[model samples]
Target: MTSATETETETETATDAASRPAPPLIYDGHCHVASTDFIPRQFMEDVAATVHRALEAQGAAPPLARLVDAYAAQHQDHDADALVAEMDAAGVARSVLMVPDFSLRMDCPLTPEEMARRHHEIRLRHPGRFWVFIGADPRHGADGIAAFEHAVTQYGFEGLKLYPPCGYSPSDERLFPYYEICAERGLPVFVHTGPTVRSLDYEPAHPMLIDRAAREFPGVEFILGHGAVTYFDVCADLALHRPNVHLDLGGFAGAALPDGWPTHLNRAFRLGLNHKMIFGTDWPLNRMTGGLTRLVREVTEGTEVFAGVRRREQALILSGNLARLLTRKGNE
Candidate 1:
């Protein structure tokens, strides 16, 4: 294979259509602070090897320090100070932190409660720069609901992070109570819509189920995470037809790299879903610095595929849209 293309640094201030700087302040709408302890062992080894291979393919010997930093970043729960420091470097003003439900999939030491507690502590310490999405395995039943309520009422978590791959489904009757709580509290529910590796129940993480929840709870807002991964058309349909449903582009850009997820996002733009789309980096899995660049514009030239989208619309997707949701929810 030919050499991998060189990735451009983000110093260039001009774009193809206009001579403007990148958005001054971005809000990373989705992020995960789960430590390396959360990742399954074999997967860690696989990731390390993949990085080594990529470096080798580029005709450079992978430095041990590079591998060390890669492993360290993913292996440790992010520190609030460090996260904010990265934000300063990336020009990100705010970020939405998310915890994952590893109860069924990994041998994680921290229970959902402990994880949420840690995340809450960070949000409190960091204040305005960080918000949180509470995650749960509703399969834990009544106990899970109680913990969720406590997180919302006691700690003031702003959103719900549902991991259907953790032995549950978005359309399950058990989730209705949780969805109802979100509706009542003016919090949006974030559903993992699309395939997820490292879990047994990936098949049930569907966009259709999320759409059903959006339909059933019209008062509640549902944001499909990962842009429905491989279910772009379905996500676009739901976001277009259902005012309460939206999508966040988190892990998709990194997962699809190079050309990025243009076809899928371009479809959303063509259908006028800009206001419904939120920018996210799925941090650690993808870093805020470079990952965000590929998603918003061409790495080398800063050309965006959704050329017809106005600057204000792009700005909204970067931060304004999610800020609007947070504001509206606050008044509700």
Candidate 2:
């Protein structure tokens, strides 16, 4: 029943849409290879128990064992096939996949070395889709340092993943040797910078704890994971003062922050922290919140999140900064 003029207009609009340019590709600054064996069983149990208790309170309870099994099943992507599909759909050009060392704090099936190997294999399979970071607790002493060096020199890992909540401060002297290796290789270090699950020691992971290390290792870039979620004000302050410090928006989508993600991001932009901000979805961690596609669209599709942020600054956050940081190391 449409008139010829209206039908013609519809066709013209479709053509215009098709002709529009694609958005710039993104480089996820923080992510993980979601394999249950790589993670601590106690941590998963704690998460499932919390969910089970909440469901029970709501009279929608499933058995605890079933809930735990379901949770474990959700993170069984030992291979990067599913991750690459999600990345392609989300237009993510690459992701930095990190393995957190929990051997000292919890019971994990694979040691840090084994976990690194698994990630290296996945990277080999995916070609240009991933950059791997090996986790090593300095408490492991000489053996740990050797394993980390081997991962970097032999396995092609590019960065260091520090889980401060695993009961160590970022500035702990024991980590100096590891920092020395990273500095020599021009690799960046990603430190968990906010509260984590109750099973871990959250106090040791404060953003301020990284200040000393940032000062000590001026050449090594320090990225505060979950920086845009909790303790954002402190994280922003640190990034503003320290040239070596940066922030990653990994848990921004899922964390129940005070003013929400867009507001927090806009505030950071207002404070001129846009250039130091890095895009990250934390992958399977935030999949419940519409996955990577939704996170990308939130920053790129509209002017809401980037209203005050200029296009160039937005690019810096989405991929430019991470590219410059990682590629600089690779080139050297």
User: Model 2 residue 114 lDDT?
Assistant: 80
Query: What is the alpha-carbon lDDT for the whole of candidate 2?
Result: 0.86
Estimate, for each residue in 126-214, the C-alpha lDDT of model 1 and write its tens digit.
87888788887768889999999999899888888887776677888888999989889888888887766543476778788776777
TM-score of each: 0.80, 0.92
In order, the Cα lDDT scores of the candidates are 0.73, 0.86
Off by over 4 Å in 2: 1-21
Model 2 — which ten-residue stretch has the worst lDDT?
323-332
Question: Model 2, 75: alpha-carbon shift in Å?
Answer: 1.2
For candidate 2, the per-residue lDDT at 303 reads: 63
Q: Which lDDT value does model 1 have at 215?
A: 79
What value of lDDT does candidate 1 attain over all alpha carbons? 0.73
